[model samples]
Target: MASSPTIRYGALAQTFHWLTAVLVVTAFILGPEGSEDEVFRGADLGRQAHETLGLAVFVLTAARLLWRLADRRPDPPDVARWMDIASKAVQGALYLLLCAVPLSAVIGTWLEGHPVTLLAGIEVAPMIAASHSLGERVSELHGLLGDTLIWIAGLHAAAALFHHYFLKDTVLVTMLPRWLKK
Candidate 1:
């Protein structure tokens, strides 16, 4: 919360953010294809792991939004207005996708008529679609949104690294895990 170059994230926020990032990267690396394909295209355990972690990402992102609102975030490096706008635009896009991608995914899965099992046997009620075409359409939309999210997140990471090294700023410190850096 301090308007200084200090760790702005609380313990809970940092833990959730880093852990979720790990799971997200793992999921992205694995891709969506499970062992079996063709008729039965279910999440399988690993993909379920991905989707489950996605839901957690949604929650953590929500928490981060709240934390950001509660505390004044430090500014990016002193730069040109256009550069700052670009940085803010990228961050805003990331935040929007972070929230939206999970929502669409959850809705699409439920519409496809499957119980979204969580860490154990916990499941959410199906948000059934009116028709198969409708379900597929929504699912397609979800996939597109997810792909866009990945691209945006890449931009986010690249910008962070640029700021940390080239721009010589403290921008990346808040998000780095404890052991990763001082």
Candidate 2:
């Protein structure tokens, strides 16, 4: 297939971006809101869904990063140098959080002497030695990171909207799927 154009992302990249967004949001919503004990109490459907979606996000992100290595991205829009730097920083942070969030969850669950539960009766046993106290701490960090991810993602979306409306540029449109582009 042809590489992405300087003007816009290819369909595959767009798909990866939008799908990851959807999965993250869905997983966040489904996450159980409670203490580590309550969250790991049982195999509830909501928790299972959240775990499954989180895993999907993690896997999707890994695939996206691999694809990024081989794919050509659209050129950055004309903007202030500071804006470019800020954008790059935000992008890097997002990628880091994408990996960290799920990893924290897995490590925390395992350390707490619990298996990472997913849908369809799939469970991943803990690979590390148990340390309940450390697990609790990591679980708390996971919650904080999850919240941070949402806030950062919101900021990212706001920036895209600003580019589309105020800057009147192709920055937002470039990542949009063909059907969504004008």
Candidate 3:
């Protein structure tokens, strides 16, 4: 069978893949703890950082989406039928949640009249009124999306491990860093 041309996923894809991966993990893990709850009320700075990173992930995901559209990526191996289907489904859901989580935050922030901070370490200017119901709802949705994201990411990671150990294919390597392949 003819094989596809292989190279590191275009630079943009690699950047989006790794950077977004780290940011997603960061935002999902640290976001909840930084919520406006009693426990972290004293650590408002941390909370702010969490919010900033959360917003950053959202924006980066958007950029990644745009980049994805510009570059068409190849599918997984034809031999791994089940893995291909499963990964695609999980990845689709992940993409959905990726957008949903940030959307919820945008809605919540707008409701709360909070400025969307992009981590310039500056003050956030609120666009809507503070203490609004919409903000609360969006915040709740954000939490739910975060939970979903965690599951999808875990499954994705596990699948990569499985691919390496069991499938013995280069599926995972397709996205690996350049140095690792050498």
Candidate 4:
């Protein structure tokens, strides 16, 4: 399929982009937050849903990365040299975290000897024997990573808006929905 030659992303690339964004944001929102005391809130179902969402995000992101490698999408906008470098760096970090966050949670959950069930109730067995202390530590790291993803995502969106409104560039336009395009 031919992609837009100028600033528009191809349909497949745009689909992957938006799907990943929505899943990542949803996983962040559904995942546990704040103190350990308030983490699960004694809600087993909520925790299960959170775990399932994280796993789904990991799977989707893996496919997205593969798609990205194969797709001929629009190139980066003509921004300043420094901005280009910074943008690439941020994008790289976001992709890294997209994989890392969910994998960490899975490992942590497995190590804790907790059952990881999918949305359909398929059980994922533990990789290690029950070790509450270690699992707790890993869980802390998982929470930290999730929080960092949220912060970075905020910065990313803000930067896109800045580019579109202030710099008057194609950076944001390329990724916007067709109905929202100016």
Q: Which has the greatest lDDT?
A: 2
Error of 1 at 150 (Å): 1.6
Candidate 3 structure quality by residue, lDDT tens digits, 45-83: 555666777777778888888888888675556565776
Q: What is the lDDT of residue 22 in candidate 3?
A: 89
lDDT of 2 by residue, 49-134 (tens): 99999999999999999999999888878899999999999999999999999999999989999998999869999999999999
Off by over 4 Å in 3: 1-4, 32-43, 112-121, 128-131
Which is the leading candidate under TM-score?
2
Model 4 stretches with alpha carbons more than 4 Å out: 1-4, 33-43
Q: Model 4, 36-133: lDDT tens per residue?
A: 45653454566667888888888888888888788776777777899999898899999998888998888777777666766656678887787878
Error of 4 at 57 (Å): 0.7
Write model 1 residue lDDT over 79-143, tens digit each, in one string: 87998899889878878888887887777667666566665656777866545556566767767
Pairs with backbone N, CA or C atoms under 3 Å apart (clashes), candidate 3: 113-126, 113-128
Rank list by lDDT: 2, 4, 3, 1
Which residue pairs of candidate 2 clash? Answer: none
The candidate, 2 or 3, that scores higher on lDDT is 2
Better of 1 and 3 by lDDT: 3
Candidate 4 TM-score versus the reference: 0.87
- In order, the Cα lDDT scores of the candidates are 0.69, 0.92, 0.72, 0.80
What TM-score, to 2 decimals, does candidate 3 have? 0.80
lDDT of 3 at 103: 77
